[model samples]
Target: MTRTAAIIGGGVIGGGWAARFLLNGWDVKICDPDPEAQRKIGEVLANARRSLPGLSDVALPEEGTLSFHADLSEAVAGATWIQESVPERLELKHKVFAQIQAACAPEAVIGSSTSGFKPSELQQGAARPAQIVVAHPFNPVYLLPLVELVTAEQEVAERAAQILTGIGMLPLFLRKEIDAHVADRLLEAVWREALWLVKDGIATTEEIDNAIRYGFGLRWAQMGLFETYRIAGGEAGMKHFMAQFGPALKWPWTKLTDVPDFTDELVDLIAGQSDEQSGAHTIRELERIRDTNLVAILRALKGQGWGAGALLTDHDKRVRAATALAARAVDGVTPGEPILTQARAVPLDWTDYNGHMNEARYLDAFSMATDRFMEFIGCDADYIAAGGSYFTAETHIQYVDEVHAGARIEVKTQMLLGAGKKLQLFHWMYAGERLLATAEHFLLHVSLETRRPSEPGPEVAEGLRLVAEAQADMPYPEGAGRTIRRPG
Candidate 1:
């Protein structure tokens, strides 16, 4: 069954929420009075379509439908998730919640995007107080995965977390709701100090930002604060670091409790400095730059399988598993046919200076297909762990056409030969009906214990026999067993 999400207000954050849900295959409904809501969400969706799918190796689910509704009831009708992103006002929120509860289902999750308001406050006059939860997400919500879920109800939190995780978000559940959730509180502290610094003429806005992006910001990106500080402690760890820095905490270095008055002069000074720092680019341009930089950082973290990157790696596995299940549901791996192995968009990093997928990535795609094929024949991770797996003895790739970033590609594998101790396959890669490349791989089953070629296990041998026998009568693939030769 398809899930539906109703976005209460279609501003930047709400639009981002819509894009995130829509891209993740959830139908979206927008309930906003603003006439520009459609255009605004369209731009956000454009950016999402360009960036979000590239985050995963497998293609994302087909984008869900989007529609606009003039009435709250119409929008909330049949919506499983309703996100409220109106301006932060308690009275206004209460009114919206009453209207939402009247129209939305009792079990539908009502997520408030208020940065500072607690769920309790939002649920004050609600018919179903348990349904209202604070699911505050960061800006550029389509790209950022963190969603602060504040709710006292365990059931509500679990349901929200499960839904958010399905859409590739990390829900930080806070049982005890505070005025400002965890991340914003940390940001507010830094904001206050930065304000004081500017007010005191100690550092300009640009200078303060420079201090972060060029210094501890990088460390915080991957390791975070305590771990970074623990590393700073050297061989002794957190205890040593705390002992050294503990005294300094009382030395009047920070004005944590004090705030600078928000005078017009101060506002002008900061805004002027910010304009001087980044006046050249439009907000959209800045957003794109931020997104690109974030993608690079996230991809790097994914490679290391640490921090947020680890989350991304796990999400990829989930996507792959879901794809496999869907494929199996459609047709059990039938014999005498080319098995659909890989279907995904070419990630941004796969391209090189030529602005097309680089040479090595072709082999990477084919290798992924090979792995999928191995799994189909019962030679999976567990099988390999039990000391038997396939090792490529030889591979030949023919690049017929160029593939660029964001192109949806599919790989289909034909089991040319699958016999005892040997597996031979031909893979054809395509973008729709356009054949882009072909790869032939000859692999031998090997014993992981001794790292030598060995006879196939019973389960695997039976699988190989089924496919090999079924496909034995199929015509030989074109260009099979060919060697590199001069054009003729």
Candidate 2:
């Protein structure tokens, strides 16, 4: 079914929500009274369009329709999912919720993107309290996957979670209402510590930030505090670590006695330090730097299948299943073979100092194409799970041209030859209309159990034979097999 999402605010958080829904193929209608709402959301969407899809090679759903409305009721008329992102004033929210409750369809689920408010508070005086759930998300909602769900009713929370998950977000449901919810509570604790560190002249804001970004942030990115502590416990785990560090908990390393008052003098001191620290970059430049670093870090984690990396893995699977790969010759005897097997956006991290794609990414693109080729020939996840698979024994690559980030790239795969346990294939990679590189791979069918080269089962072998025969008459790809020789 086509989905319609209504966003009730047009600020940073609201604009981000709009981007996530609109880009994920859900028709999005936004209601914001501000005259500049359209421009605000457009700017956010521009940044979102550039960053989010580049996280994975697979394509996102074709973008859905976007429209703005002057009236709240008209904006939300047919929406199945209504998200309220109005300002955080209690009276203002109560009024907004009442308006939303009156306008919302009975089947629609209304969510509030309030970081600090509990769902119960947001639903105060609402006609349908059960429909109002808190679905708070971080800034740049289009990229980050985590959404904290807090609601009075369990079933409503679960339903909201399902909807968020469909759009590639990880919904964390809170059983009971809390002032700040889980993540904010953790963030508050760190914030307090950082503030005290700054106020007491212990560390400057930049120095403290560097401490986190350089030292513990990387560990925290993949392994949360508890897990890292658990490992610190050594062979015995959490309990052992607790025993060793229990005494230090009372030490005066932290001055978390209380929050320092924001006196004018202190405020100026902090602001001055910030200006000197990062005054050269605009907000947008800083944002891009932050986002690029996040993409790189998350992509690294994805490689290891941990933390936010795991979220990317899940999103990529769903994306691949929904993407439009070229005509797949699954049975191998199909009439027209697939010319293009794998398509992906060039992620930001693939570029090096030269501003073009680095040398190694060409091989990575070809390798995924080879994976797709195996899928075409009937060796997919299920086949590999049953202990049948192919391993790349050797590869040769030719770099033809330079490609840059945000370029739409694809791999056109054709078989050179395949028989028995050995199969050779060629992949031509293109950035838009220009061929960027070519790769040749030699693969050996391997039985996972024996860990040795072996003949594939009946189905895959037949598939390979059909493909080989279909391409048998075609001339070999240029530079299929080559070696370097020096003048002797």
Candidate 3:
């Protein structure tokens, strides 16, 4: 059964929440009085659709339905998750909570996307205070996995965490709620220091941004604060580093506790500097740029299986399992037929200057297909870890058509020969019915310990025997043995 999520505001954050849930196969109902809510949310959703699916190697679930409602009650009618992303006004939040609780299911998770307000403050005089929790997400909620879940009720927090994880979000359950929650408090300190820097003419907006992006920001992205400092301690650990640098905390190195006057001069100065720095691109362009960079960073992290990338890896496993279950339910895999190995969207990074998929990505996609095929034939990670694996010896690729970023692509693999230490396969890549490319790969089963060709494990050999026997009568794929030829 498809779950339903109600977005109580259709602005950037609300639209992002809607996109996240909807893309994860939850029907979404948006409630916002703004006449432009539909357009705004549509724009956000468009960015999401182009970027989010590409984050995973496996294809995401089919998107659920999206609808807008002017009436709060109608929107929250069947919603299992209701996210409140209204402007940060205590009175306004109370009013919205009252309205949401009145209409929404008592069991529905009421998540507030408030950066500063505590759950206690939000739950004040609510119909069901326990149902309300803080689920503050960063901007571009579709891509970022972190959601600070703050609540006093452990049951509600646990339920919310499960629901958020289903939608590819990391719910960091807070033990106790404070004025500004964890991340924002840290961010506020940085913001305050940046402002002082600007106010003192020590750095411009761009310089401050550059200082972070080009410097410690990269370290912070992967290792975070304490771990990075721990490394900085060199032979010693965090204790040594802290003992050396901890005393600097009392020095006048930062104006974090101070605030610049809220004067128009400061505002104008900051805005003017910001415009000078990034006035060339529109907000949409900037958002796309940010998303693209984030995708690249996260994908890189995924390769290493660290930090947020580990979360993505976990999500991909879930996606693969779910996809396999769905496929099995529909039409069980037939042995003789080509196996559907890979189904995914072309990531933004796969494109080049030509605006279509770079030629190299063809092999990359085929490589993933090959990996999937190996798994199907029982030569998975565990098998490799146990000193048995296949190494690609030769490959031939034919690019029949061009595919662009965000295009849904699938790879079907057929076993040509699977016996002894030899494994030959053909892969056909497609976008819908259009043939995008084809690759023929020849591989050798090897022993990782001795680093030489070796007889396959019993299970792997059996799997290969079954597939080869089933596909014995199958016709050879066209252009299977072809090689590069000069233009006629």
Q: In candidate 1, what are the lDDT values of residues 58-97, reduced to their tens digit?
A: 9899989999999999999999999999999899999999
1 versus 3: better TM-score goes to? 3
lDDT of 3 by residue, 1-488 (tens): 98999999889999999999999999999999999999999999999999999989988989999999989999999899999999999999999999999988999999999999998899999989999999999999999999999998888888999999998999998888899899999998899889989999999998998788646786677546754564455544444565577667666888653544535565456445545654565555554665687778878878988766787889888888877422420133475688888999999999999999999999999999998888887787898989999999889999899999999999998888887898889999999999999999988999999989999998788778777776767788888877622112
**Ranking of predictions according to TM-score:** 3, 2, 1
Clashing pairs in 3: none
Give the worst 10-residue stretch by lDDT in candidate 1. Answer: 324-333
Worst 10 residues of 3 by lDDT: 324-333
Itemize residue pairs with steric clashes in candidate 2.
none
Q: What are the TM-scores, per candidate, against the unseen true structure?
A: 0.57, 0.57, 0.58
Q: Give me candidate 3's TM-score against the actual structure.
A: 0.58
**Candidate 1 accuracy as TM-score:** 0.57
Model 2 misplacement above 4 A: 257-488
- List per-prediction Cα lDDT, in the order shown: 0.85, 0.82, 0.85
Off by over 4 Å in 1: 257-488
Assess candidate 1 and give its lDDT.
0.85
